[model samples]
Target: MRINVLQHTPNEGPGSIQRWSQEHGHEMYIYHPYQFGNLPTSDQTDMLVILGGPMSPNDDLDWIEQERVLIRQLLADHKPIFGACYGAQQIAKTLGYAIKKAPHKEVGWAPVYLKSDIIPGIPEKLTALHWHEEMFEVPDQADLLFSSDLVKNQGFIMNGNVIGLQFHFEPEADNVREIAINDNQYPLEHNDLHQTGKEIIDHGVPTENKQVMYQLLDFMVKNS
Candidate 1:
């Protein structure tokens, strides 16, 4: 399988997802739109993985619009797409859903609750890294998959091929540290909602959440 990852920034790379791709002997390609100024042709991609970013989906950036077009094309072709955080927001916006500010920003490590056992190949609950000030509405055609206390719509799946997660399932220990130090711009008041740098590292890799990514990849590979 060839996995094409659309990276928005240097810090928010593929992280654990990269490891999963390599372990499965799948080719991993990264596109840094911020640095490269363009996206790959849809012909070159099989499964698309859109990573997180600090920017909001509403930002009137040229690359954002271009990526939106690419997302629409991927959906039209029935290509499997997995989007996280800002990428999820972009997916929501492109799918005709709305993205707006949440009541409170979700930062640090948080436990995401399973709304249903419909997650056939993954576990029920998992702790996922989160760093976002904006939230998105689930598309009418999609099913709500997971939710956290801070955010009701943590994830949604469309046509079982397109998955959007608001939390960071691909986060590494270093990624958590970087987000903790730099995400101070988004104020989070609830202490329980926050996690110390050491805490996030101590928790280590989210094995269950990582399995979800693997399951998603498996589904994509079989279906695609």
Candidate 2:
């Protein structure tokens, strides 16, 4: 399988998702729209993955709009897509769902409760990394997958092909630390979002939660 990853920032790269792809011997291509030009055609992609970032979908960036159009087209064609954090918000906004600021920012390792009807392969409770101030309304055409206290629409699945996750299912301990340290400004500026590097790392990776990441990738590969 050839997966095309839409990376929005340098700090938040593919992380575990990239590892999964390599472990399975799948080719991975990256489209950094912030640095590159327009996105490539969907025909060149077997699966589309939109990674997390600090930028919001509502930002005034020209590439953001272009990427949204590309994602909408991919969804229209029934191509498989996996989005994380801001990537998930972009997926919602492109599908005509609302994205806005949440009541509080969720910026640490938090437990997410999987829906009873959740894809059947995921565990009930898993601690996942989160770092977003905005959340999205569940698209009318999608199924809610999981939820956290701070964000009700933590994840959703559309047409059995597009999966949007508000939390960092791809996070490894190092990735979490790097993200926290690199993007410390936002957390430091907002009282509701402050967390030390030790606190974030101490939350650690749950074995069951890490398995969920593989389950998600397996599902996408089989479905695709």
| Candidate 2, 20-60: lDDT as tens digits | 89999999999888887758787887889999887899899
The 10 consecutive residues of candidate 2 with the worst lDDT sum are 185-194
lDDT of 1 by residue, 90-116 (tens): 999998889998876776677897775
lDDT of 1: 0.81
Score candidate 1 by TM-score against the native: 0.90
Q: Which parts of model 2 have CA positions greater than 4 angstroms off?
A: 116-118, 191-194
RMSD values, in order shown: 2.2, 1.6
What is the overall TM-score of model 2 with all chains considered together? 0.93
Best by TM-score: 2
Question: Which pairs of residues have clashing backbones in candidate 2?
Answer: none
- lDDT winner: 2
Error of 2 at 3 (Å): 0.4
